[model samples]
Target: MYRSEFYVFDQDKPVPVIIRNYTQDDFDELIQIQSECFPPPFSSELWWNKEQLSNHVMRFPEGAICIEVDGILAGSLTGLCVDFDPNHMEHTWEEITDHGYIKNHNPSGDTLYIVDISVRPRFRKFGLGKLIMQAMYHVVIQKKLVRLLGGGRMPGYHKVADTLTPQQYLNKVIKGDLKDPVITFLLRCGRVQIGIVENYLEDEESCNYAALMEWKNPFNRT
Candidate 1:
């Protein structure tokens, strides 16, 4: 189900990266970049699992896209085109889930759920993230997908509440420590915070909040 394709580089000029689908061959590099980008990113084993991988495969060739600078993978954006109803379905069964609860609770149709999008630290603050978002917006429009949604929870730094415990879960809620830059960047891209999932991310903490956001279909032709 999970697949990836590589655009090989023959010369030294900046590599032209077109947003496209992913292939298994991209795993080793994906994992490395992910680890460096997020505090607790997905492990190699997690990326290789059949169920997890299958969800990423696009029926169309350009299901996902990666940015390569000088033939080196720098960032990627993974998304899904589906009519999701978070209300009728459940999240427990899937190895990895996407916006199911949000859709069921809110009931949106033909949504383009952004599963994962990250750029390596070395490439941060260079406007690549916004570029990726713009590319994604165009792709969704080209394919006629309706809605777009993605967010990262930013728990304020040095302000950890005693109610929360265990660094894992706490990490998700406490975004100020290592995640401030990414959260700030998301805000600048025009995403608006919608809700906070209490204790949604931490593994040990008794409670925390997840900051949810939504970016209106920028590609919508009014």
Candidate 2:
């Protein structure tokens, strides 16, 4: 039921943009977007299925949201609540997200854990991803969560893995010497690099590694 509308420019033309909670009706477009965003070696089988998407909207409606640009499904962000401990942050994506089913979503948990965020290639230039993330930040505040956290893919790591360690690569990215597609995007969204997690995902580019990042909610009194 959460909805927000605005306009973005497309070559001097004002295009409509909408950010809202997901519903069963958006399943088809959501799946299509997943396929387009994570194609081929990214593993088609890992793409969001109807059942998992169903669990998302049903279990945590506010955390499962999508964005539309000029009426086209342009992006989405899905998350869940968890009782996070900064001292014990090691966990794989499958373990954290319940293999994308999110059956372990804890409504009383203090942290908003992002499961995934995808933006269509054509819509990336419009900063749609950031807007989607902003919506999730709103959700964290509305739900009174302490922070937002996620494991970011280092898709650009493979090209330099032979010469750099994962931590070294991440350090360089933080120091502005390197730019990773996912990590850099998250950095721009006000997320801080927490650490590197090995065996976090099945991505070849990242050598099965993921960069942990988080954004603390300033308004949370707890």
Give the alpha carbon lDDT tens digit for every residue of 126-198 in model 2. 9999999988888888888899999999999999999999999999999999998889999999999888889
Give all TM-scores, in the order shown.
0.62, 0.96
lDDT score, candidate 1, position 44: 44
Tens-digit lDDT string for candidate 1 (106-129): 122466656668788876645567
Overall lDDT per candidate, in order of appearance: 0.52, 0.92
